[model samples]
Target chain A: MYRLSGGAILWQHHPGLPAATFLAMPAEPAPAARPVAAARRRRLRADRARQLADLLRHQILAGGVPGGVLPLEDVIAADYRASRNTVRQALDLLRGERIVERQPGVGTVVVCEKYPHGLDRLQGLAETLREHGRVTNEVRTVGPVSAPGPVAHRLGLPEHADVLCVERLRRLDGLPLSLDLSYLPMDIGGELLGCDLENTDVFRLLEQLTGGPLGHAEITLEAVNADAHSAAVLQAPRGAAVLMLERLTRLPDGRPVDLEFIRFRGDRITMSGVLHRSL
Target chain B: MYRLSGGAILWQHHPGLPAATFLAMPAEPAPAARPVAAARRRRLRADRARQLADLLRHQILAGGVPGGVLPLEDVIAADYRASRNTVRQALDLLRGERIVERQPGVGTVVVCEKYPHGLDRLQGLAETLREHGRVTNEVRTVGPVSAPGPVAHRLGLPEHADVLCVERLRRLDGLPLSLDLSYLPMDIGGELLGCDLENTDVFRLLEQLTGGPLGHAEITLEAVNADAHSAAVLQAPRGAAVLMLERLTRLPDGRPVDLEFIRFRGDRITMSGVLHRSL
Candidate 1:
């Protein structure tokens, strides 16, 4: 984890080498998170380092630094009390997380988030948000339509079966977020179709209908453009950065049941996954 | 689909649909796609519906419009020689597969091809690009270091285990495209650490070492800012757009083996995925 300070290069050696480990330095007691002004009196160097990393990490997350601009060694060393080598080490740590990268001539830059999906996991979009904090979900449209194409193929729509399309706007802390449309088997979700979406989670709503999802969900990720309707609800420019997530769900009996399309604000979010290597 | 030719739109109605359901104009052969000017004439108007779709789809696939921006109604209508409503319908078809969305004030923008993950189907960074056309991988750094919390956690690495960190500069058609690093528990990947990296697919290499991957992966999505290194390697500004992908892999028997972080040029790629609803 990078300090929101200036990313001042936490110089602790990789722990547990037996002899070279920096000796813990007593954890510094987190220094009671002194205010910005206290540095002149106590622990000057440590305070300097902490503040530096904190400031830099905040800038990186806040979009203040723009994207891909690498802070120079001279700039960082001058801004903070640490040496150039210390700053270099911190930059390398960020590189380890794929948060930044070094280019032969371009120096270093911040890596933007990749808009992707965790298809193999059972986590839903909102669920993913709640983990970090409370993001917002705005329900815009909910209606029935004839399931078509792969969606039809996945839901087994009888070529003419009516499907419920739940359109909503997803946000992080009230910002313009993802806009998407979800389709449900009319015969199943038709009754719950009229339920209030504003105050409830769709998964919970689905549970009320099917007694609870069997638990396995298959997901796919893609890149697409924003259309007029989604554009209006997401409040993003018609063709801004938008990430699309599609998923298929099944009952315990292994029968596929629903289809959903989730669009995310490309500038604000990214995705990661775990892969299990075969023996 | 939205075409860049004077902001042209493409209309595609299922041939099997009833006459009234057609909701489109008669098919007219596309003018620009004529064999001689196939690439340049791609901007023409009077094209067959299928040809229009192909042209539009080609533009989307070839990264024609910046970030894949698609003009909502007017542009699409103009391209397909169809009504605004018909074009919207075609856009809807693409939305199902996460090909596009509508924004509140922005109209419609194309999603670049950067986000692609979250399904049983998984491939390495190298493999995905190869499918796009021609690409090359350049090894920049490949060495070992103590695992960090995230990578350590994902790879199930012990607190002190030495993990091999492999960093590379990926080029597509000779242009520097992305920067990536993969972490592997030394015990698991020690054998191949010294072999060819630029020309070898990690997955294939792993398979040759121990066995084939059992094919299981879990993904998470988040957003971050690009740093100095990222800016330099991606050849973007100090803080340009980027996409970071994190992944972990294990053996068939469930042994953690590989963890990777990939950073892509924000404006250079697009992403997409599919989803199923809850039963």
Candidate 2:
């Protein structure tokens, strides 16, 4: 009986024969052991593939494989003393995890890391940009006014009640990236009207003014075509794609305190989050 | 001093005055209590808005409000004995949750529920469609061949190893929805070549064949423009937007069992998920 172990076929009668000798033999095993032997061979091949995948995975992650491309199958097969098929299997594993992708004409290449948007906590665009570099705010308006219908409802205020509305353009490294419009209930945010909002983080200012940490928020993300106003503000062409994030932040007491409508240039932003089955 | 409560301004000295009567009076509270009284009033209004939002939420969920459009602001205010601003606030809350959306010239309308793609488990496209209605599969091909470089690597097989590839078009209510291409290791899937895949669920077939459940899957979702072949299979125009879901399912023994590349017509699908901070 010939047994397959880790991509190598071992002859029970000639156990020391190398893989080349086994391949040279007739490609047939005893009929009685065919089922069991075939199953074992499949498992062995799978194991070898997994081992190779792990080695390549480390190489890719460690930057050992610069340019994100693996060598030709024939080269890898010769180096590992394995068939081209085995090398292909290892490459497929990486593709499954999206560590690399294969382009028809260009061959397999590493995929750059995507931006991750942690959905666990409420994070604002200004904070996201500041993490990469310094962020500057261009305050367009900040004043107390009779809140609009939707704004009033969001802040738990009476329709048309007095509220503080702040409109600003956020820039990273002096380039405009997003347009933000925020509304705060005047009862708690009236003092914000007196602060230099352009220099202060709105979230921090809110925390200081409210004298407490902000709690959970409900956020909605959607894609929309850029309207004329948003296009001009984001410096994108009219009708260009944009990502809109609408957020309603609440106090620990479950009182909705602020509503924000923000538009990001889609080409410059990608939101990613890991979805879990259980919490 | 006068106090505002539930959208009604009440006079402490003239408690018997009707809400309409108080509205007709000069809009002024005692100067000594103005700041403190105003804060209290704001909180009270916020509470009212929250209460209204909760009520409307229940109504929306219960399908009490048909046609997805809520009653006009004036109507809700009069029915609830609240101001229009209070009603607006309630409406805005629903909007923030994406339960409703306001359309220009169309009034406030309920938004259609988005499809939630739970990243918690490995679910096949057929199962997802069956939940909505009957799903039918059209098998395009089922054969064995030398696995492509990427496919071989993913399956942990030798380069150009023998493998079984299945191509199918999935339909819902007789309308094409998505195109699915799956690659499986021939050692395990070779027998599948003889099965009628049009009537069988591939995942279930795999589980039965392997005598175990699929452990987990690493899935990636991205937007892509439909290519000629995919567009023709999905019955969508070339260059139309499509959602690509690539999944690599593994066996409980930590071996990758299958690789699926699925493309859904963008207009027919919207993937959504609630991201929590911790699991």
Candidate 3:
């Protein structure tokens, strides 16, 4: 049987098995107790690593680490007053949860928790991202085009009906994230032709044009291979798997207002939320 | 300009452009109406394709097609009373929506929508799938083991505590869909040691064992690359992206009971639900 004693708790265990005895130690161990002391040191290191991981998780969730990049390992170790091995262990914990990824030469980077959109809320991407922090839009195209057959049907318009197409590359903290393509009926979208779309959200613009609150949306999420257009715009490799959100937003009275196709890089975004059972 | 005439409508427009004019026609035209007749036939074919697609979509959503595979194109054509080409077009529509994928030599298959679990419901996968139809479970393992450090912490048990580990491969319509690993405190899970797991849902068994309602769960969703163990069991390629749901379930009085890690094949499943904006 092996006996381990630190400052407070004394534990006795069979070698290579779990501890079966517990007792209190009154004083520090003698220097002859080298193996048990080493074990205690390892356990203390593990505790320290867990503590550091908890701190970093909170900081990351609170947006303290902007741009989703963590500091160098040595820097983190120095800051936490822990050994390099302890810091490595802590980062490994985050990596398992996908909260961070270690680049070969770039150090550990905090990569989890992309702007979360509540699947239950009828909100636009821009509005959702804005609530998190600063977001910018690069409007690629805004013009009238003949609606595609399927799009026309979804928008309750006749085949080949006029529609306004607005394509934007959305950026969060200056990092390219999602590509948003929205189609709007001509009668409602025509008014926004002269307006600056780069500074305005299409959902908000549609709300203003229709003079009513945008109601619920029928949203479908799918894993799709990025086509040429989406791959180039989202900067993902050709045919890479991406999360596609197809949304048809309607007015409060059930009049369809916009048909949007949004593509997000799967590696860079995670959509998550809590579900409460309704009584 | 090209002039096209159909029953009750006449239009003149560029041959390959959207129609610019529409007018009513009184009677059947002479042999000169052949071109317009062909165009009308094409339009009708397109309409028929869309209608077929809608019907198939509804049928698939209602779980009418078991094993997540659609019928052969000719079979679907015969069933819908549409031409083979029209049936192909309908399948193409489903492909664009990521609802079905065409296997190399196996024909088009309904690939997506594997028992959608609403983020709003506090339901287990087996429970949700059972509500729709039959579900079977293959219990891979059930035994007492030392809890891994992270799992022990998540379940609020001491490090190296004895816990019951259960691994199950869940099947829907006889096709393996998900691999689930659950760690439960021995004091709570010990009662289930002798129970038949294949025919019983774990959540239901837990409720019975604990004699209390399983309370809210802290759930997290992430896209993760499948590891070798998971890839082999789930029959997905190594490094294939999959949806991972990590849940820590609690009892009504806030006692953590189970820590679960569930992996779902991304292409075969989609988690989607409506969100309402709270005023």
lDDT (Cα, tens digit) per residue for candidate 1, span A70-117:
668887665433456546666664564355678888887887443333
Best by DockQ: 3
Candidate 2, position A55, lDDT: 46
Number of clashing pairs per prediction, in order: 117, 23, 2
The DockQ values of the predictions, listed in order, are: 0.12, 0.06, 0.13
Quote the true-contact fraction of every model. Answer: 0.17, 0.03, 0.18
2 or 3, greater by lDDT: 3
Of the candidates shown, which would achieve the greatest lDDT relative to the real structure? 3
| 10 residues in a row with least lDDT, candidate 2 chain B | B21-30
Chain B TM-score per candidate, please.
0.58, 0.60, 0.62
Greater TM-score among 1 and 2 belongs to 1
Total residue pair clashes for candidate 3:
2
> What is the C-alpha lDDT profile of model 2 across A85-126, one tens digit per residue?
668877775665456788888777877333333444565555
Least well predicted 10-residue stretch by lDDT in candidate 1 chain B = B42-51
Candidate 2 structure quality by residue, lDDT tens digits, B1-279: 332222323332232432343221112223354455565555445545544564465456446677878888998776555677768877865665456899988888877343333333456656645566666677654545455455678789886666565666777777777777677886677666556567667887887888877776666454444544456668876544455565677787768778776766654554543332223
Judged by lDDT relative to the true structure, which candidate is superior, 1 or 3? 3
Interface RMSD of each: 11.7, 14.7, 13.3
Report, to 2 decimal places, the DockQ of model 2: 0.06
Per-candidate TM equals 0.52, 0.51, 0.63
Candidate number that wins on DockQ, 2 or 3: 3
In CAPRI terms, where does candidate 3 land?
Answer: incorrect
The alpha-carbon deviation from the true structure for residue B109 of candidate 2, after best TM-score superposition, in angstroms, is: 10
